[model samples]
Target: MDHVRNANPFTSQSSYSRGSVLAWRIVTPVSWLILVITSIYYSATKPHEGKYSRHTIWGQNSHRHTPFALNSVIASLYWIALYILQVPYLSSLFKEDNTLPLTLASHFTAHNLLTFGFIHLWCRSYFWWALLLVIINWFNLTFAYFRYPKTPRVTHVAIIAGPLAWAFVSLYWDGAAAVHSHHTAARIVANVFLWTWLVYGAFYIVAFKDWAMGFALSILAAALGVGQFFTAIIALQWIFAFTIMAVLFVASLPVAAPGVFGGDVFKRGEVVSEDRERAPLLAEP
Candidate 1:
């Protein structure tokens, strides 16, 4: 029998469904696959046409390959993001050492803050907003870390949605212009990839399972797109990014599927570990 937990604001135990879990399992990675392919195609083909003009979906001349500086900056951020995302998986490698996850998580999250600040702090806007939301995201996880049994279901929703929503909103703003250069196009694709996670996060926001895959995949995808941005030939950098991400994606797939991530998976951990109820063990006397 299923051991249903306490009520969340948006859903009850009845909200849990195997169909939803399976849908997410199938949809989460597939969405990233589609986005990555489209991004790679755009980065490869569109930059070659000898034209100062390319009509975008928003009807802007969105095909001018901008200078390398913009992409270089964006690309650096992506690398940093990838590094940060890797920490969790690596923590699993350190599972024999119990405290390693905390040490690694702190180190990387700090690195993320510094790197993230350096990248976007100088921007015209969105710094405070980004940092604040990130703190909230971290708060959810921190709470789950220290107080799993007491942490409510709604908090898990926050953990699931926080980063995806922030990245999604930020990326949506990316398309405020057009995808002229490798940088612009990269940002746009990052937005769309993140948008997929936001949709997946929505399922968890109400009530669902296996949030690890959606969360990890979305972060890695956005990081890949960010890392891809560069002043070099679009094709070269895109291929590099795609190759690196393809490997990362495949490697992470099993990790997410099994919840092998060292840290708290989805704030509440998995079902069996978290459920508070247990029936009599056949009264084996």
Candidate 2:
């Protein structure tokens, strides 16, 4: 698969492997490893600095304690709005006529507003969340790429390259086809990117790993699975996806437990050297 350089410009080298360009073609468990590591490290270290941290609602001790709170609230609002709209209970509401509920329109409006606004905000922060979205979408493309028998390595590369190419075209070159959308295409693309990641992520867990990884994967899968049921009932896939994304996003808040907190390193206060001059003199002597 075509590899994009690591998004962090400060990195000395890119994280992608040049030799195994087609490595992303297969939906191996390892594909999720990068995200798992990134999420865990962010949680454990609670680093105050970095692009990802900036967009995060929560941070180390001083900042917000619950990073995922905003996401959770938003997700809950979306679901509640759908329920009030009665989109899910449409069949029962209009048994004989089978007319669609007015609530469906409201649900769609709210879903688009939330998603578009979130993406715009996330992009401004240059947070890893946006990049993660892209990566998840690419993972889906990879699955499609490998579905064929004897898939050519170049084909795999093309699949990986597609998004990068689109990103470039959208951002820099201003390709007309990529743009000029009424936001429908953009919404669909974003959903595909997200759901693909969740689906492949589930498959990856089953294909490789033990209990711990399996358990984590199961939780993630369960979230999506529950979300899917709601979508089927309400015909609100975007809303369902957005709600699940919010829950997953909130659940990933970074928290340092006991000895794990970075603050412990500075518990007593900053250590000071009392004999700095004497040490220098002794060294010279």
Candidate 3:
């Protein structure tokens, strides 16, 4: 695990120990608790905006609905496809079969290449985007907090911290496995992390309004386009597939928001504030 920490800024901290690990596990649930409480508070007191409610494929608004319905549908489909693709590989591994070494190598190689390429091409972009989103969302949530200070603060905290906590857990687990040269463990952990991200991406697409989603999607598409171009240079189809997957993940983040394919017309929340306003009214006669 020291090797894993070699590149981390937190290397000076004590190595993760059984107690610290246990503490993290114990505290992780607090985020969930906050999520529940905040959800309830928001549900009870927040003004319901029926026009912005979830819409059906036919474009009819479904009142009193959460974006989770659509998110669940898409996530379920993705999960099924993922399981179908992975089960055979896992079964083979358990049976001590190595017949698919090339396939496995190709899969992992593509992932590694794509990850590194993306980091090289878009890590700074993603960092800025993520940073901006974090700041904006924090500001918006702060407004919500001040406006309704009595509302359980847990939910807002959970919403922001949940993904981060999971990311750390995933990194720690994967890092430990890699440190021990447990390739199988690392692969499994990585797959689990990917699946979690896939679901989160789905939720983002289904839950956010249009402008936010569109901005994210555009950035993602551009990144993938660049990543795929590099993959072409390397002559690896798997890298292209991985890049597409990454794009899909990015597109999903803002689907749940207001607009989407329609662009500015569907923008919502503070995004509208950040955006330039439409042209001023013409001088009246």
Candidate 4:
């Protein structure tokens, strides 16, 4: 009873092995650095031709000519923001007495490796394979999201929810490319899939109280709307995208904003400081 009462949720380290902590401390940064270098390399070396070119989307040809595609510039900016958030999250894992849970470490490693594979496959015009990678990444990130600690909200966004949002959006973008079918049935299915963003955003917000995921989806929806609008001025896809964006943006406020609805959403309330004169700690069993 005393041990249970004295346990600190934020700082408990006994469950982790030293080797797991050490390995991830070295592996995580190296994997992230590799991804950065390769992304830059692919973006620079791949030449822009046209829709049929191997470097169709990432080169000077920024437009993807698809309803579900996000504006390339906006997508790039989102990735940049995600990467910047990752720096602090990765650094936090290296703090003294911080033990990396095996489950999180495994998912993190797989997500990074699959992401590395995805960039290469995507640049090579292997849309089907890239879509496969994104699917795996989506499931892996979802598991990581639930497994991860919720406090210190920035890291939660950085490590799990943000990447999950990207994966969720990429499913449509990559799936469209993989199919590349102009049949009315296929087009109808694609249009229907767009609404899943709204469904997913709503589910996360209500079920998990995860405003970060909802916000990420909202921003991505806006980007998709921008792309769809420029692709076809008369189409309703852009209108649908924008509507989803508005709905998610509004719905997410309760869990994120502070007042009657939200209270210290980002504050690490579990981490009690010593100045508060906590009860004396008991040795772990």
Rank the candidate models, highest TM-score first.
Answer: 4, 1, 3, 2
Clashes of 1: 2
TM-scores of all models?
0.28, 0.23, 0.26, 0.82
lDDT tens per residue, model 4, 1-285: 535422333344654456656777889888888887777777678734425457734642243455676776777788889889878767766766444332355676788889889887777677888889999999999877765534356666777888899899988887777777345676577678889999999988877778888899999999999987887788778889999999999888877764656576632323223242222223445
Report lDDT per candidate: 0.36, 0.30, 0.31, 0.72
lDDT (10s digit) by residue, model 2, range 5-29:
3322212222334332222222222
Ranking by lDDT: 4, 1, 3, 2
Q: Cα lDDT for residue 160, model 3?
A: 23
Candidate closest to the true structure, highest lDDT:
4
Candidate 2, residue 274: how far the Cα is off, in Å: 45
Output the better candidate (1/2) by lDDT.
1
Residue 210 CA displacement from its true place in model 3, Å: 7.1
- Separately for all candidates shown, the number of backbone clashes (residues 3 or more apart, or on different chains) is 2, 2, 17, 0
Model 1, residue 272: displacement in angstroms?
A: 4.2
For model 3, the superposed segments whose C-alpha errors exceed 4 Å read 1-181, 210-246, 249-260, 263-265, 275-285
User: What TM-score number comes out for model 1?
Assistant: 0.28
Q: Which ten residues in a row have the lowest lDDT in candidate 4?
A: 271-280
